[model samples]
Target: MPAGELFTVPPVRGGTKPEGSSRNKQKEYQLVRVKNTWCRVECRQEMPTTWEEDQVIVSQAKIGEQVTESGVSWVVKAPIYFCYKVIETQNLLNPSNKTLLYGHVSDPEEIDEYQKKTQKRFVVMDATVEQIYGSKVRKYFEAHNVVYKILALETTEETKSMDIVLHILEEVHKFSLDRRTEPIIAIGGGVCLDAVGLAASLYRRRTPYIRVPTTLLSYVDASVGAKNGVNFCNCKNKLGSYTPPIATFLDRSFIQTIPRRHISNGLGEILKMALMKHKGLFQILEKHGKYLLDSKFQSTNVLDCNDDAALKTTRLAIQTMLEELAPNLWEDDLDRLVDYGHVISPELEMNLLPALMHGEAVNIDMAFMTYVSHEIGLITLEERNRIVQCMQNLELPVFHRDCSFQLIKKALAERFKHSGGKLRLSLSTGLGTAEIFNNVSEETMMCAFAAWQEDLGEHST
Candidate 1:
């Protein structure tokens, strides 16, 4: 048989028809396109035969219609909507009873009860993490009899591509995951979370998944956001979706396993949030900045819920992040406080990837913008210097060679389009407060960049 052409169909004549007659109709009509008043349809048979009322017509005025040139009228189904929540927790690797688990380490004795109400689980972990805690994770699962498949991969800035995401998708399909009950678990830093989250969003056309961030950056920033994507064509998060995980489990315990630079990298985002929205958080970072960078909460790590300072710092950072994100989960509003230092960070980060971590780039961005604030009198010289000094104390980079005035101008151009034709540049008016701007001259930006470079040289020497 030859291929058929695509043609519109008209609704059946007479708005209503007998149900029994349509159902028993000998001839069939395949609908092409349906509209409010008419439906485009085609007849496969050579000639019209007996029409069964019930077969074609679903209701009195809908679906099947009476024979006539005028089409019938019907109602289309209602639209669909989705909603979910993100949570914070400790030691998510521990088994649990409730579908949604949050907060603190689980007691060994409580495991028995917690596991009883659990569902099957699978994990997609960063390969590096598996090397560090593979045995521990396996032991925990075995102790609880929680059957799970682990798919570990190298999730690096360079490896954050669609090809990597597709590989994860293949692994997810192999598990034949149950979309609703069985959740896919992702464990690692931001890159790992991004790849895994993107994979979960695709599987079964959006399977529920969980996020277990293993780094300071992921804990405070990445895991909490609904944006999930992999890079493409050298653009950060070019191929992505705004799909929030079913839940996000924050375990400070995981940060203990990584080096201090990663912790400092995370402090970058914490600092960004502090400056943008939380004055208290900004003050906390300033006062306890050094303590946080070097304090050992546990014998094994930087995070100890027992350490009052560390707990306060971690809680404030997470809380501030949620405050900025909760209202703009989909970024429908581009004039966001959370975009504080993000205007130029994406390009700067990618340009310095493997050498400069994401948060490090953001710190550099914030530092430059703080200089911009000072130039415009939005912030005082002392305040601007204080922010830079705090970043320096935390071991975060305040300046990067790649973050030049020209680069910033170019980045702002791209940002204007991304932000819906508005500059929407977030600039700090003072500590813990920021305002968006649609215009800032290149001369002012260049001066700020120059001042940052000079400060960097002074600090270095």
Candidate 2:
């Protein structure tokens, strides 16, 4: 019988129709057809049968079995897609799904409109935000009559353990938050984002969350990705999940109070994106990077303003990041351009913390990779110099003592396993273009490091 044809069962040798056959020791068979109120099935093997004159039988293979004659079988599956938006706003408290608001979020009235819109209660998780923003968050929530609680976290590398996560989950259970609507609002740098995001994901299987990245590193890279992670067992981000937040808000106002070096720290991730994909953004950085590094935009304090060159440059960098990440948010595809410096930077960053920032470690990784690309003839000497110079010009580090060849070779071995036994290393083929490499040799890496050291004298790691 053709597929999709309906059928019924016939009576047994005892002249009794099969009743509740589902519970009996029955063979799997595809149904064929029915006549009147009775059912019939074409048997593939001899068995007890009682047939009525009105019943009809048809031939078909058993269910869940494939015929060998034609030697063909197929099943179709639909692909899953995930998508979200990233926007810039002057003052997030003014009521927006995600906003980049300027000035301190001190005024309670600014967030009044948002309280009215959301019916669900919220829990604010802070790492360093309160120290930076003070009682503004508490006062705003209180004035708006928003049901909320505050949880303070250290958000340091040492504190990124399960204990911190469980502590936050305690609050989640106590608040009885509606997983579908109310979200945990994470405010701080990448550490806070990762810890809070992990807590939110574990509750009720998955809880919606909001991200307000307070540091520049979180703004350009960490918060934008769907990845949330915490260090564990002396490993960087060993425990984590790929859960995207409902939205991320970028506000330069928060970036203003931080030290100037932090801006350079964020530049490492920005430079990674520009190098791998957007040469135009790279050029923008080459020209206006110093202006941004100086916090000129925030110093001017232009709220509800546009047409700033620095702001445009930041937006371009963000747009470039989103363009690369939106298509592969969950990283189902392992071959990603964004994985350029990230291949080794995680281990490099965690091991050298206090001495090195996340972005700075990435810059050091990219610097060596740039030389590796050069040694392989993938990029010219001039191109290699330009890349290094661009990083140095932004006050980003090009080398660290811990980024030794021995350490790198060990990390590469582990990364090779993690990348399915292939290198999957991102290399520069040209300005704004990147290619993957699977056959980089240790000797070539040594030569790359030696060349980097020779070019950068006292800066050698």
CA lDDT of each prediction against the hidden true structure? 0.74, 0.72
Best by lDDT: 1
For candidate 2, the per-residue lDDT at 91 reads 56
lDDT of 1 by residue, 41-97 (tens): 434433223533334432212123333233432323222334555554555565452
TM-score of each: 0.77, 0.77
Positional deviation of 155 in candidate 1, in angstroms? 0.8
Clashing pairs in 2: 1-59, 7-33, 8-39, 8-40, 89-100, 90-101, 90-102, 91-101
Per-residue lDDT tens digits of candidate 2, residues 111-169? 56444564444555555677656476665655555677777778877788888889888
| Candidate 1 Cα errors over 4 Å, as ranges | 1-86, 94-119, 296-307, 457-461
Task: Give the TM-score comparing model 2 with the true structure, all chains together.
Answer: 0.77
